[model samples]
Each structure stands twice: as structure tokens, then as C-alpha cells.
Target: MRDRAEITIVGAGPAGLTCAIGLALAGKKVVVREWHGDVGHRFHDDLQGLENWTDPVDVLDELAAIGIAARFDHHGVSEGVVFDGQAKPHRVRGKRPLFYLLRRGNAIGSLDRALLDQAVKAGVEVRFNDRVTETAGDMILAAGPRRADIIAAGRVFDTDMEDGAWLAIGSELAPKGYAYLLTHNGRGTVASCMFSGFRDQASHVAATLAFFERHAGLRMQNPRPFGGFGNIRLPRTAMQGECPVVGEHAGFQDALAGFGLRYAVRSGRLAAESLINSTSYTDAWRRALQPGLRTGVVNRFLFNAAGQSGLDWLIERLARNEAGDTLAQAYRPSLPKRVLFPLAHHRFRAPLIDPSCNHENCDCVWCEHGDHSAAIAGA
Candidate 1:
């Protein structure tokens, strides 16, 4: 490898690849160092989502806007059944898709493999099995999540169930987080995402499987377990030792729903634009994703406070047309005050006042302090 380039990225994940491709297309020399042999190696074959709830534009259009052609095998899903702790399933059908389910791997049509092909065609050089710990000069850190507030235990299996998605909201299955199952083309993933009470993760996953078997009719055969974690804290700065951190490394994740694809792509684009224009990456991301991210933080605080009953209420409200309209209004930038203000002011009580953070695994600063950090940063 050359000693220097116009830009060097540490990780070849979605964010790093996007930034490297953009920079290379702009006539800049860009090189990416990935610890894995190929793209999406860490994700295995787990099913992930490109969420569409936060933005009004279709996910395909959004990816196209950033110069990504969505040629991968993805299934658009707008309808799903939400089950509460009581095991009562509520049907949620929206006019537009809530999310698109896509496979995460280096398979023929996987998102990561597609992006890698585009990057190579754009003249971006990628060094496989090259793990970079520190760097100098103009660099972008996109090494994925550093710390996790929630751990998701997932399994890929062959199932006879029809292609669809289902979400379970309750402490019994997922603790403060949520459990989800998505199946497409005979492949399925069952995962339990938990924010607290992690000591019983196995029990939780077992319970989640049982719940799905009972309510969603999940039939499984061969199973392979894979897991991942999420970082959900407000970022203090975009720079990690002069290198601009992109993607989950900068905490560019959804605080409420753990959807980071949009944020990852958006942050990568912003970082590339900042470097090209000689602007600050920190300022650019703040301008692009700030207020919305802050609102998500507040929404998460309230959601965690609401517990199982609150989840039930949210599912019930989501079924109504008026609530759908309200959600659309919340997405508008002009209605910032009207959108998340009610969630913060709602009279909800936490089931546990002080949590050990699952045996001191999570810091829970955002949860304990609420929006104080955002206030200090003027978010």
C-alpha cells in the first residue's frame, strides 16, 4: 500500500465504502483497509432492514440520491403484526412500506457486495484482511460501533413460514428493546434485542422463539446463531484524533428504533461532502442529522420509561389513520416542537428507577440524564 492517499478509510463497511466511492469519483485517491476478507463478513447471513419510517422518500430513491443503485434482493414490507407482552397481536398496515428486508452478507445480490462492486468500479482500492488501529493525515474512521447499549442475539434458519416480518414488544422477550423476526425466500432470522437484563439473554431468546411459534406461526429447521450490538449514545464530537469518524463509530444510529442504515449512508455522504468542500465534518453532520437524532434520543427516553403498557399503546395508536397522519407530521422539519414534545411530556413511569445496566455493561448516561447532554450541546 502507498504511504499516503487523498483519503484513507479504516473500515470497508457501508459508511466507509460510500465515503471512499464518493471521494474516488471526485478524483481523489482513496483507499479502504478492512480487517475482514471481504465485505459483510461480520454480518454473516443475518437479515437486516433499511428502515423507511424516518424519511418520506422511498428507501430506493434515497439510496439513488446518494448514487447507490438498489440492485440487491430486497423485499419491501409495509405490513406486520405487532405483539405486546400479553401476546395479543395487532395488525399494522401502512400505505408505504415500513422497511425493506435485505440479506446481510457477501452473497451475489447482498447490499454490501453490491456496494463493494460499485466502489471498485469507481476506482477505490480496498485492502482485505488489513486491520488498522490508528492513522494519520486526512482519514475517515468508519469501523462500525465501538460500544453497545443493546446486544442482539440472532439466528439464521430455514423456515416454512411465509415471507413477512413480525415485531414483539415486551420485557419478557426483549427487555427494554424489542424482538423481531423476518423471513424471505425460505431463510429467516429470529432475534431478541435487549437493552437491560442481559444475564438472561438465552432465556429471552428462548422466550422470543416460543412467542413467535405461538402467535406468528414460525416453523424452523436448521438454525445458526449470530449476534451483534448497537451503540445508542449522543456523540460528543465527530473527530476521533483528527480522523473524522463516520457511521456507527460516531454514534450515528437511531436512538429509538436502532435503525442505522439511513444514518450511516447520510453520514458518509456528509463526510465526503465536507472533505471535498473543505468544511468541518462535525458541522456538516450536525446540520444534516442533528435535531432528528436528538429527538430520537428523547423519544427513546420516553419509550423506555413507558415499559410494556406503553408499547401496547404505541402499537394500538399506530393502527389508526390519525396516528399515521401524526407520524407523518412528526417527520416534517418545521414541526420540530410539535413532533417529539408530547412524548417527552407524557406521564410515564419507569418500571425500575435505577438499573444496574445489565451488570454494568452499559453506561446508560442518555437514559439516566435524559436530554441534558443534548441541551448542553445545544441540540
Candidate 2:
């Protein structure tokens, strides 16, 4: 049976929209089906969260590629304060005094408009308020959490905490990552827990409130008006078969950091290019995320280490003038092989060691049989 469209994309997030636009630009017949009544409505209001973003240039390039380059506005910040659970706060400023912050809605709106326009111009069809119950031909799933149903079932690691600025107080109450307190256009503050676990979620919230009380000394006793929503990280293995998955559907979100805007856009473009050119999905995945995904694994391992204390150490280290640049440089994957190999060894090797070497009667065959055989041969 012939497919209805050459490509069918489900979802209208950054990934889906970008894919639609890219494919349309390639002159492929594409149909973007969005379940929502209106585009960009999911995050229409209350986008207050931490805006300490990296990769502004890449984001701009993606926007330009999709024809929405004008919507971006860069916010300059002189310094960012780091607060560990018990340590004194450390302040770190950048030499350039510039970083990127944007309203999520604005970015989504721009992409949505540009994608819809391009799709129409290229004679592609777009269906809004239409839910795709199933996918047939060259399906691209970018539906975030819902994509789980379309693919093989995978475990979901949930950390149910809000993401916003009010989380500064007792930010230690969460897991490893930072808490954010942000206000959009002076409407109201949004308190958030970026990467705390569900088990510690309530404690994180209380500690956040306490932190605000102690530092800001403001007792706004009203409950937070906004609820929390989490972005999930899908396993890379989820895209194992014929069709390709893009955006959050493929689990491109950084599990440790919860920053996925750029990743989603980039991955979407890659997926679109692969589909249009008849390239392999796995090759597209690797080419699109050759370096970022590897580093993300290392960082996620660090975030899961030593409770939240280790995270505090990392944050404090970054707040120091010298250490911040070093840490930031370390995160970059473009480092020379001489520098990269040692860092990779340091980050990944120690975790690979087994602690049960000394335990007798343990089930580890290598320690028991292999070691004993070698010792007996020496006799």
C-alpha cells in the first residue's frame, strides 16, 4: 500500500516542527499532525525558569534555517551566583557578560510559524488539532513522553518537581542539578526543581521555600500558582528499527541538566535530512550527535555521584574564576585527542571498577576461578 504522505511527523514540539520545515525545504511531501488545538499553546504563559543557557549561536543558526531568526533576543548577564547546601555562596562572572535566555513560547511560536509557512509553500500538508493514533509510512515520532507507546516499552525515570527560580533556597534538597527561580516579564516568580528525584521532591520544595525565606526574606505564603512539568530523556536504543525518532521522542533531553532546546532542534533537522535523502537512521543519529551524546553520558554519571554534595562541589568549582573556564572547556567535545583521552579515562574508568574483589565466596567467576587458576599455575 502506498503511504498517504512521503513523511508523516507526529508532534509539534521543536523537533517535529524543525523536521517538518527541513523536509519541506528539501521538497519532500511532509505532513505534520499536531494534537493541540493551536500551535505553541503548550507553553503559552509562565515560562519563568533559569535562563543560564549555552550555545546561543547554534540556536540562532537553527532558527535561521527554519526562517524564524528574528524572534531571538539575547540577555546579557555579568555573573551567576552558586549556592551549595552548606557552603558560602560563590559568585562567578563572565568576561563577555553575555548568555542566552528566551521565552520558550517565543521560540516555539517562531518555529511553528516558519514550519507551517514553508510546508505550505512546498505543497506539504499540515494538520492541527488532529491526533495521530498510529503511524504508517516513514513515521517520525517527536511526541515527547507519548512516543513511548509507539516504540518498544522502556522504563521511565520520574523526578516530579517543579522547575523555576523559587528553588534556590535549600536547592540541596533536590538531587544533583541546580534549581531555578525565574520571572517572565515581571508577572510572577516560577520555582523549579531541575533534576531532583521524586523521593526527595517534597523536601526539595520545602527547602527551596526555606532558602527563599532566609535569603530574600520574603514570606509570600501563597502556594505557587504554577505546577511542575518534567522533560524526559529517552534511551538512544529506542530508535532501533526502520523509522527514525526525533526531538524529545528519541530522548534527546539531557537527563542531568534538563536543557534540550538546541538538541531537539538539531536532532530534528538531522532526522529530516536523513528521511529526505534515504540515509540510515543510525548514521543520521551519530552524525547529528557525534560529540554531544558522549559527553552527556559522562556528565550524567557525575551528576548521579555522591548524592547532591558532589553536585555542590561541581557547581562551586565552576563558580571559581579559573575552575569555571576549565570546567566549561572540559564540557566541550572538540578538545584534542591528547586532552580528551585522559579526561575520558578519569571520568569513566573509576566507575568501571568492581568493589567485590576482596569478598570470598562471591559469585564473580573472574575473581574466583580465573584468579585461582592463575595462582595454581604459578605453583
Candidate with top lDDT is 1
lDDT of 2 by residue, 116-219 (tens): 55556766677878876655667788765421111100011111232222323243544444554443233333343434343334455556556655654323
Q: Clashes in model 1: which pairs?
A: none
In candidate 1, stretches whose alpha carbon ends up further than 4 angstroms from where it belongs are 1-4, 322-379
lDDT of each: 0.75, 0.51
Q: What is the overall TM-score of model 2 with all chains considered together?
A: 0.68
The best candidate in terms of TM-score = 1
Error of 2 at 303 (Å): 2.4
Backbone clash tally (model 2): 12
Question: Which regions in candidate 2 have their CA more than 4 angstroms from the true location?
Answer: 1-6, 40-44, 48-58, 72-78, 95-99, 105-124, 146-172, 194-203, 216-224, 228-241, 306-310, 322-327, 334-379
- Please write out the lDDT profile of model 1 over residues 1-379, one tens digit for every residue: 2235568888888899989888887778888988779998767688999977767688789888878888788888878877766888877777777788888889888889988999999899899988775567888888776655666776899988888888988778877789999998999999998876655677888888898888888888899977777666567678876678888878788767788888888888888887887878888888788777777665676687676677678778876644335455544445654466556534212322225453344433223222221211101
